[model samples]
Target: MHRRHAPPPKLHPHPSPLSSPATHPVPYLHRLLSAAAPAVSPGPRFAVEDYLVDTCGLTRAQALKASTKLSHLKSPTNPDAVLAFLAGLGLSSADVAALVARDPKFLCAGVERTLSPILAGLTGLGLSRSEIARVASLAPRSFRSRSVVSGLEYYLPLFSSSESLLRGLKKYKYFLSSDPERVVKPNIELLRECGLGTSDIAKLCLAVPWLLSAKPERVQVMLACVERLGVPRRSGMFRHALKAVESLSEEKLAAKVEYLRNTFRWSDAEVGIALRKAPLMLTKSNQTLQSKSEFLISEMGLEPAYLAHCPVMLCLSLEGRVKPRCYVIKFLKANGLLDRHWTYGTIVRVSEMVFVETFICPHKEAAPNLAEDYDAACRGEMPTNFRFTWTKNRL
Candidate 1:
């Protein structure tokens, strides 16, 4: 019996479909249970990308880029509170968006611990709510910086008006990060040593706050540059010259000087004289210089030397003030109503009210369209046929 036992029956790889359920209850019940169980749900997920777009006003691309940096935000709780708090502080939606765009991390900052305290400190330093909103819009990181309080403490005293503070903050957001004792104080002292008065220093701060935060070496270089331009340190125009020189790079200053020399055929000395008279002329674009020079020299028959002497005339608007007034004067002279002795200097330098009273109002009877034509020219709608007779008279 043991030696002749038949081989065991072969088993199929799969169970037969016709097999009785009772015969293979384990496998059948396993399949049935699997089919009956509910699908395993995914874990709870945060929709940060959607949150950025729908709530924060970020574009899809901006939201994607900002999301990577802000991946830690598991929900919109913190950011929503931040936006609400900022809105309570009078920040518009656009302002909040600008702030968040500038520094997205600001959206995650703790409202009570970080943002509220900074705003309170700024308000304590006399910044109105609107100004705080502006500062936040311009430099959002300033709110989180530990140096903000100290920066405000040092700068608030320097500015007399809220407008000056606003301007300074808008121009130089790094005022919060800059070391007042080291950078600002030294630069201000250097300006004082350069013979700038308190009023002049205030004006400089209002005009160019970055200069106050300039490195000591750069401040020294700017001082030397202005002095080399033959601007007397004791002169009233010294502050203006310093501002002009500091505002421009050496390359820009050189280029502007060369442009004036080559275009106007002015000697280097004449160029320097012009800059001394009106340092702001260096701030004008090359296009402005070209247009004004062409009009004054080619059309008005004014000498290049006269322009170099009266550089302020070059600063006037070519279309608005200069051309319109010149047209009025020419119309008067063409009718023999204007005095031949009246100088271009007199015409260009008068206040707007005086100009209208003397040129536009009195000449209405002689030239009915004088005011209309002047208005048209001032609006940059110069008539195509507009022309003026050039006189060789000295002004």
Candidate 2:
């Protein structure tokens, strides 16, 4: 009943119906969709999947996988620039494809920041455009890592020439990815400590770069193993021994040693003697050991002691060099075309030209089929009925 109740407490104007939550309630999911729509939607006329397949040479599946990493790309401007830069460097479409396939993120790399500097650095290193292209094609991953320039800088001087460098790069692409300070340099130092000079080390790196890339401790162990086999570090055979040991695993070495001992009934001393003479004997397969030993022992009546003394005879090709030459010698002796004084070791160690002339050319008149048979045996087409009379008197 108050006379003037402040004009009924004067309510503020009601919120407009347009702005009322009850009148136009936006669901939570709808609000989220509205907020995120801009980001998830594709740009007009720019489809990343399509761009990858059509321009980058990726298949639909590859593009789909690559698009996950490149979702931020709304247009082809950056990738197009990357492709253009690669193409301008003489990379064929196949080369570009290989690069993208190996590392799809390459497409997203900054040209000026990442790729251009690498290329410029390569060129500055005296790599011609063609050689650079070859490197890129052969090892695209070489450019994807940050260590390429450092790798090249460390390795370039080790090679005698740019041709050698190119050969090493092509042969072992892992050179670009290898850690010189951690892996290469330490291993090289270990090799030097083992009496390898700079030139010898360079030869090893060219022939077997993986050996230098091995763990330092492992390389040291291998060096020790080689030395334990009686190969003197100062001897020329030392390098060959190192190469053969580097190619073998511990299990393989064990297996080969066991095979030589058990299969040939060789004592440990004899095996050691053989291995010291020709370390490559340990690298031969078990089948090769059996076949060659059988031919030398049973067919030619060569004593195992002889092989232990001259183990390099095992390294000769049984089919190509040993068997064919042996057949020629046997044929010549049976027909009295060759002197019986020629030894098995002498025949095997001779040059191919000498063997052909001494065994094949001289006897072609008396035995017209001798040269033909020798050639046939070399090609692995020897007749099943082929036999040679073993001359007991010659031995």
Candidate 3:
């Protein structure tokens, strides 16, 4: 029952594929794997081997991966052999270079599978490593400066639209349309009021196309034409049109007409014709006065004969002298009082005397605020039994 059992057969640990030394000729792999593998039991007999294995502590997994990748990188067909050989697993030579070059330690994954293709594309475009690095180092805004036009036309279009471009163009169209100078709104308005339509305005602009490029000025011109053409006054001649506006008169319409006639050297007949045509040229005052006078004499009991003499008599009272008496004539003419040929100093003096006696003689007052007898006032007396009659002569 106590029979001795044979010792269990000894089991040996199977060597890992990764345990084999790297045979790849890639110097980067040779250096990396040899340095990375753990030191053998007695430490390397050669100082070179001892230093590498002791200093770098690369794991077996790191060595095996580096060797396998370097095998492919060593091929002539590989575009980036040096870079690929340096890369372990997915890393490239460019990635190692960047990592070595950067003064500060960074946690970013070295350019591996994802970034390698981009570097490859850059290499295909004939971009040097330094140029790629420089571009990569630049911020987006700085990079755009390298190709502003291309950025706007092509790249920006990817983000914007033709309509957006048109809006920008419209905003700056003034600069395109005309000369920077020679643009003024009022001047344009002057031209437009002179009877220019939109087409005419456009033609004018075409004649001076550079004006369109002018800001406010070009816009002003177009607007002016629209305003002038759209209004009732056909002729865009604003100043002349304004002349017509200034011609409107309500106070002393006849006097204003005379003034205009004298100022413009127009004949009375012509002036009268114009006034008749545009009755608004007469002011409300003149209209009212005319209507009042017309109503007083024709509709009321006031006599036209007495009213006709009123203005001349008033002139006599105002003049304080019986003279060459042109003043009397002026007064009569102004008030529609004179005959067509009523002149001559003899007649004037006679009329003055009559006016002075009949109207200019002062009058008296009986009741307070009573209209007086023209003669009684001259005598400085108050008349009894005063009738409150109003007359131009008393005034």
Error of 2 at 230 (Å): 2.5
Query: What lDDT would candidate 1 get against the real structure?
Result: 0.80
Q: Write the per-residue lDDT of candidate 3 for residues 123-242, one digit (tens) a residue.
A: 554445654444333221222132322322331232143343333333332322222234434444555665656544543443343333345554444444333322233543332223
Report the poorest 10 consecutive residues by lDDT, candidate 3. Answer: 100-109
Residues 1-395, model 2: lDDT tens digits: 75755555655588865576776655755777888877676458778888888998888898888788877887788888889988988988878877777677778777888888888898998888877777777677677565687787788788766677777776777767878889889987887777778778778777777775678888888888888777877676777788888877878778778899876768889988888778877778899999987888888888888888878789999988898888787777776777558987888899989888877776655676667778888999877667543333332
- Give the lowest summed-lDDT range of ten residues in model 2: 386-395
By TM-score: ranked, best first:
2, 1, 3
After TM-score superposition, the amount by which residue 196's alpha carbon in candidate 1 deviates from its true location, in angstroms, is 2.5
Q: What's the residue-level lDDT of 382 in candidate 2?
A: 78
lDDT agreement with native, every candidate: 0.80, 0.79, 0.37
Report model 3's TM-score to 2 decimal places: 0.15
| TM-score, every prediction | 0.79, 0.83, 0.15
* Candidate number achieving the greatest lDDT relative to the actual structure: 1
Off by over 4 Å in 3: 1-272, 276-282, 285-340, 343-395
lDDT of 1 by residue, 6-69 (tens): 9899999887765866567788878889999988988678887888788888888888878887
Q: How many residue pairs clash in each candidate?
A: 0, 0, 21
Q: Give the CA lDDT, 0 to 100, for residue 348 in model 3.
A: 37
